[model samples]
Target chain A: MKKTLNAYSEQMNQLMGKAICLPHGPFSELHEAMRYSLNAGGKRIRPVLMQLCYEAVGGKEEIESFLMAIEMIHTYSLIHDDLPAMDDDDLRRGKPTNHMVFGEATAILAGDALLTEAFQIMLSDALRHGGLERIRAAHILSEASGMGGMIGGQILDMASENKTIDLATLDCIQLHKTGALIAAATKMGAVLGGGGSKEIAALEAYGKYIGKVFQIVDDILDAISTAEELGKPVHSDEKNEKNTYLSFYSIEESYAIAKALTDKALKLLEQIPGDTSLLAEIAETLIKRKN
Target chain B: MKKTLNAYSEQMNQLMGKAICLPHGPFSELHEAMRYSLNAGGKRIRPVLMQLCYEAVGGKEEIESFLMAIEMIHTYSLIHDDLPAMDDDDLRRGKPTNHMVFGEATAILAGDALLTEAFQIMLSDALRHGGLERIRAAHILSEASGMGGMIGGQILDMASENKTIDLATLDCIQLHKTGALIAAATKMGAVLGGGGSKEIAALEAYGKYIGKVFQIVDDILDAISTAEELGKPVHSDEKNEKNTYLSFYSIEESYAIAKALTDKALKLLEQIPGDTSLLAEIAETLIKRKN
Candidate 1:
């Protein structure tokens, strides 16, 4: 499982690097900024999950472009989230954030460009394939990233800032913010792979459970880990006075909840009737992940 | 021609208002900001151009969604451009800019949401229709608005701030910045209307000329008009030391250049075997318009 994840991550890294290599022009600075943030090191979890799910469902088509598109969306969200007007973070991945390295205006444009480019890649792929599947995949991806999904989550999180909130509100925020895209990763993979509605729904449910586990573990790590280990500021949720699972439960309790969610996710994988061993391993690993 | 244009504009206004009606939620503020900018009055030139071109090619499908999508993209660009770190304007269309009214963070998310929702609307339309034309239209829209088009132009514009750039460079900036989306309007309309490549090419060319005419007129108005007349600050280009048509030619000369471009665009419309009279009149009016 580790080797498989590394291979997917490396492949995504290479594909993403090639995706934005335009000739040097008047907007080369914008491209540079986009590339800088895009290549900033992370686990490549989303794209890897997308690929893993694709394979698990017996997909054989080349989905490199879609993988790159999803990562671009994720990277763009981070770029804008780190803007002076947003999180105002100076560091990400243990280095200066996009706005810190590139001026704010360029950073903003870079984010816009990445988002636009994601659609461009997907639509271009749809044009070549001449099918409804690509369009359906795009629709799912867009809704996941758009107002009702990731951005909606962001707004709810911001609106809840400096105020204590219940576990239900936190669940809503995390589900929209992080769960939408994570579920989208698996759902898109299933759709593109021509999975039936039943299989797609099961994987989607699995993705939801794992998404919750991911977020809860994230909250736990933020409360307990060092900045060096995480490559971003520690205690950021606390600093922002944001509500998290930690706000409602102890660290041990959070871990236990994450473990339970992982088990639920793994159980869903068992019902999928495919080679979901890797997915099962991934969910288990996610609960125990240190970073 | 004026009546027809107004008809298209009014229809677009009604459709756009309906397009973004989200049920109130924790992120209702985001929706409000998006709707505020979407409803902030403009001529709806891009959508109108699209619909005109669509009819010019004898298209009879329901394209209200596509029209709304284009306007959404345009409004998102405006919202971001007016941010404190970008153009930093306080007013737009006679009201406070998005950030001024909604605050910066929500403003940024609003811009992000608008762009995402544009895709959401377009892709949803494609899913219902299930054809390559909608995908093709979406590809064109994304490309025109992406790094190589509008955003590219913006970066160049910002990079050239306070610098005495050459006329060619100014043309490049405007072509990417303003001309790309304008051209995309006609091209997408032609594509969606099932026009052949030759017809699409011709309308695209016409769009390019009118796009230039629009920018030249904008520069002329910025140089000569009042803040009240334009509903925004005047002489902003001069204040920012940005190059424009007025930088290289007197007002009369700029008008002459714009008139020539309009004539060229009209000639292209004449070559098209359709009811291009409205497009011709639009080009002519564009060159002569005040605020």
Candidate 2:
């Protein structure tokens, strides 16, 4: 499973590299800035999960565009999140952030362009494929990552900074800021894979649970992992004065919650009538992830 | 035609007010920032033009979502464009800019939310309407407003700042920065209205011409009008060291080009078999406007 995950991550990197590369466009500078951050390596977890979900649901047709599109959206979010006006981070993925390399204006434009480009990729690919499924998938992805989902979550997180907020409010922030897009990626894969209502619902449930697990684990990693291992700053939540699972619960309690959510996600996957071993293994790896 | 334009503008205002008013969302601050600029009151030209194109092509179904969606995208651009990172303006439509009112972080989130919300509205509406047309329209708008269109143009415009750029670069800036979205608005109207390929092509051409005319007049107005009259600061082009028609040609020559483009837009409208007088009148008014 680990070997397969690595292979999938490698494939996604190559695909995203090609998708974002525009060598001779008039706005090549903007494209360069976009590529600079996108190529800054992460686990490619979102796209890999999406592809794994699709494959688990018996999908065989090409989903490279969807894979690339979701990664673009994730990359854009990271770029914007690192802006001086947002998280104000200097480094991301162990490199100078987009603004650090390209300047603020170019970084902003790059983020904006990448967000818009995601829709363009989805739409053009859907049109080429000639189906309503891609459109549905696109719409689902947009809603999940849009105002009510990721952006909403981000706003909540920002507003809660340096303030004592309740667990409910903290839950809202976690659910939105990171959870929504992760759920969208998983659900979108199921939808595109032509899963019925039952399968779709199960996958969505799986996504939601794992999303929680992912965030909780992230908070734990931030608390324990070194910057060298994390490839980004450590204790960012503390520096940002952010409320995380670590803020409200002990390390053991946080790990328990992550474990429970992973169990929930795996159980949901079990209800789906498909080979979900990769999905299950991924969930296990997520909770056990060191960085 | 003036009365009709006023009526459409009013209708758009009402629709936009409702669309942007998310009374109890978790991200109400972001929503407020979005509404701060959205309700700041422009001529509602894009939505009005979309409606006119729809009506001109004999479209009768409710297009409130598309109308509101385009306006949201336009408003988001305005919000981001006014950010400290971008134009750093204090005023828009004679009031404080979104960032000025909501702070930089909220304003940025607001802009990002609005962009995503545009897609949400279109997709949800399309699904409810049970047609591929809305999805198609959404695609066109995204393409026009995305990398190779508005954002691309913005990048070129930004990169050209504090530098001596030629007429070709200037043209690229104008065509992309403003033209693509305008063209999208016009073409989207025809598309949603069920206009055939010929009508769609003609409307797209009309949008391109009017978009050029509109930007040229904007430059002229920026050069000649006051902040009070224009409801925003004048000489911004000069302040930013950005090129425009006035940068390369005499005011008279610039006016000639705007007039020529407006005339061209009207001619294209004439080629389409519909009541296009409103569109023609709007073009004339845009070129001759004092503000």
Highest-TM-score candidate? 1
Q: What is the TM-score of chain A alone in each candidate?
A: 0.97, 0.97
lDDT tens per residue, model 1, B198-290: 999999999999999999999999999999999999998888888898889999999999989998999898767878878987898898788
Query: Model 1 TM-score?
Result: 0.98
**RMSD, one per candidate, in order:** 1.3, 1.6
- The candidate scoring highest on DockQ is 1
> Over the stretch B163-258, how does candidate 2's per-residue lDDT look in tens digits?
888999999898999999899999999999999999999999999998998888899999999999999999998888888888789999999988
Among residues 3 or more apart in sequence or in different chains, the pairs in candidate 1 whose N, CA or C atoms overlap within 3 Å are: none
Candidate 2, A1-291: lDDT as tens digits: 345778988988888788877667788888889888888877898898888878778798988888988888899999899999999998888899999999888888788888888888887787778667888898888888888899989998998899999989998998988988888888899989988888888888888888899899889999899999888889889999999987789999999989988988988987778778878888899999987
TM-score of every model?
0.98, 0.97
In model 2, residue pairs whose N, Cα or C atoms come closer than 3 Å (at least 3 residues apart or on different chains), thus clashing, are none
Candidate 2 chain B has its poorest 10 consecutive residues by lDDT at: B1-10
